[model samples]
Every structure is written in structure tokens, then in C-alpha cells.
Target: MMGTIQNRDKFLNQIASRFNRPRISSPIGKPNWKSQPQYEVYKGATQDELLEILKEQCKKIHTNFVTTDLKDLPVVVNDVVIDFGGGPIVTWKDERFSQWGLDSLMKQEWPEQNIDVFEWDYTVGNENIHKAEHANVGITISEITLAESGTVVLLSDQDKGRTVSFLPATSIMLIPKSTIVPRMTQAAVKLREIHQRTGHVASCINFITGPSNSADIELNLVVGVHGPVKVTYIVINDL
Candidate 1:
């Protein structure tokens, strides 16, 4: 902070002098990467097969996977709710979930306990919803699921807060089976295309594979140590 304009120039000059170089007065251009990849990242399966692979990989990593038709989403939600134990349920606002007819499903005859479901609309334009971080279950919509890694891609915006996936004890992701890609490379390429075509860049794009965990505590595995203890994926085939 104490350095002046002259001092900054002097420091650069000192380094240039040490290297026996001189400063050039010219504008620098951006670095150019290769136009094509040297080797391809193989996407070796069809959508159906990729979905199967994603489910298998998820099981191997201790992440739960559930396949249900759009009509049965509510039933699956209830099952997840039961296992999540009970605090509160937070879900997306008027997003694709509503488009796929999941509005009534969220409220379809659950236990008569005090558990409440907080749809994203409740917080719109100043709804003052509190204890959001304490919600037991957090549900989100993911457009892409990489089969090779069993990861779900979430594009964050004003409506889709990043906290929805990271703050709760259990996180549930709803992914359309049609969007299941065989590899991460295909997903990345699509994201890049979207950015280029629309000139719109999301603040955060999260690739979630499973629950937040760590094994650094004496090499002993710990779940939810960093964030949610459990992660579940509900892949919709009929969506």
C-alpha cells in the first residue's frame, strides 16, 4: 500500500534489469488456446445406458439414486421425506417442477406431524422465510447428470440459491433422464455453447456428486462434516 507510482516502475525495472531485458510499449493480446482437442473424451453410451451407469456409479459412492415416473414423484418425495427424519422441506419455486406437474405431489397426504413444505414461491420478492439453513431436506432441479461421474450440474441464479444444495442435512436432486450425458465433457461443451450464444454467464455452476464428506480426520470417513450428510437423486424418466 505504501508503494508509489515511481516505486512500482522501479520494482519492475529492477526485475527487468536482473533478466537483462528491456520493457516494451505494446498492448498484450489474450492468449489463444487450441481450436480443437488433441484427444477426444469418449461418451460411450446411449441415454438409457448412461442413466444406468450413473445410477451404478452413484451406488458405488454411497449416493442414493431413485428412478420414478413423473406421476410417482410425490410418492418418491414422501419416501425421501420419511428417511430424512423431519425438520422442514425446501423445494424449488415456479421452475420446471411445476411444469412437470409436481405441485400437488408435494402435498400428497404425508404424516400429520408439524413438518411443512416451503416451496420457493414462499420467499419471492420478500417472503421473509427463516430457518432456511436448518431445513432437513433441500430439493433442486438439475438439467444435466454426468454418467461417468454420477454428478449433477446446477446453474445458480437469483431463484436458485447455492445454499439450497449445501445448507441442509439431506439434498435431493431431480434430474430428467433425457439430460443424462455419457461424460462430463459433453456437459461442459453444452455449457460453453450456452455462454457464447446468450452472452449470459451464471455466477455459479455447481457440479454435485454426493454428500459433503471428508476422510482427513485420521483417515476416517465422515459424512455431512462439511455440508449435507446425505445426498439423493431422483431421476425422472417421463419428464
Candidate 2:
């Protein structure tokens, strides 16, 4: 009996070894991923150098750059409903949004300004989340960072709803510069790991480089047509 068992194990091992193939080696082609001037140029920058590069890239994108501090955002979002889809560390829960709920933040910031903020569960695609797109702006959280390319990844997870990031005329995202990665492959690997464990794929994962812009009309160059005319990325440093 022992001999037979040993033989069976040996046979299985031999079969495994004979048929086992090395992992597939697929090569990504040029233009295989998103392209950006910022990433291409700063291929090998140290942490300190990266910070300077990020600041420069950010300044280029945002004509009016603002710090990650919440106090600074209200001034920029002058007349829009900010959907503070949580997961961002907020020091001032004292705000009306946190006090009465997200709905009240708009009411508090600018009484006349029409604002609608709410928290949604990401596991299930809630219908309310879709409404944010109709508004002039939509705000959400970020998942990955791209230091080289100056890009941010938005995972449609529970803490941060996906609709809040896409459906609005302007999509404002909060990303910490520290999370920035050099390449898209690194970002994809991180996302895959999250999906594998969570067993849920974000409805949409957006890689927003800057504002929604297109030069389609006779090459005239127009912005904010298909999506938010503006994409305000708030990079928090301290938090």
C-alpha cells in the first residue's frame, strides 16, 4: 500500500513538472498606456526631486493652484455642490457637512449656493451616486499615485464612490503626491491586488491627467465637453 502511494505521488510530481510552463512573458508596446510629458522627462528622480517635479506639474495644470488644506478649497469651489465622498482624512469634522451630514456642507459654505453632498456604500452601485455627474462638479478620492506621469487613480471602492469622480462637469480629486508611481504597470499591479482581495471591481477606474479637454473641433481645441471642463486635483502634503 505504501509503495503504491509513493508511486502515485511520484507520477503526479512527474506530470506536474513535465507540463508546467513558465509564466507568459507579454511585452507592452509603445502607446500601450497613457502618455504624459511630466513622466517621460523625470524618469529617475529621487524623493526630493520628485516633490519639486510634482509642484511644477501641478502648477502647469492648475492655473490657480491651491494647497490641500480644506480651508483653501471653499474659495475655489465658489458656486458648486461639492460631493465630499469620504475616505479623505478631514481634520475639521466641525464643518456643517460632517455635523448635519454632507448635504449641509453646501448650505453652510454658501447659503445661496446649491450643494448636495452625501455618503454612499461602494460595494453596491447606489443610484443616488449617479446624480453627482449632473451637477457642475463632482469630487471623489484617489487610490494610486503617478509621480513620473503626474497622474492619479480613482478606484470605485466603497469609501469613495465612482460616480462622484466622473459624472460632473468638473471633477475635483484629492491625491497625496507621495502615492505617485513611475509607471502605469505599477498602478495596475496595485489595483489588481486590491480587486483580488476585495472581490469587487470599481465600476470605473479613471486615470485623470488634467482637465477634460479636446482639440477635436477643426483642431480649435475645446475643454470640458465630454466630461468635466475642469479637473481640480488637490494634492495634500501633511495629511
Best by TM-score: 1
Q: Write the per-residue lDDT of candidate 2 for residues 1-239, one digit (tens) a residue.
A: 35434576566667767879543336857775566564455576665576566556765654223344455445544422343332221111123234323333444644444334444544545554555545555666557866555677876544555556556666666555566666576688788898899888886787877665677779975655665566666655534
Minimal lDDT window, size 10, model 2: 85-94
Off by over 4 Å in 1: 1-42, 107-113, 121-129
Q: Summarize candidate 1's per-residue lDDT along 188-230 as a digit string, tens digits.
A: 8779987999898877999888898788879998777855789
**C-alpha-based local distance difference test score of model 2:** 0.55
What value of lDDT does candidate 1 attain over all alpha carbons?
Answer: 0.77
Predicted model with the maximum lDDT? 1
Please list the residue runs of candidate 2 whose C-alpha ends up more than 4 Å from where it truly belongs after superposition.
1-44, 59-64, 69-114, 121-130, 192-203
In candidate 1, how many Å is residue 231 off? 1.1
Which pairs of residues clash in candidate 2, taking residues 3 or more apart in a chain or in different chains? 39-148, 122-158, 133-167, 133-168, 145-180, 145-181, 146-180, 169-228, 224-229
* Per-residue lDDT of 24 in model 1: 50
Cα deviation of 212 in candidate 1 (Å)?
A: 1.4
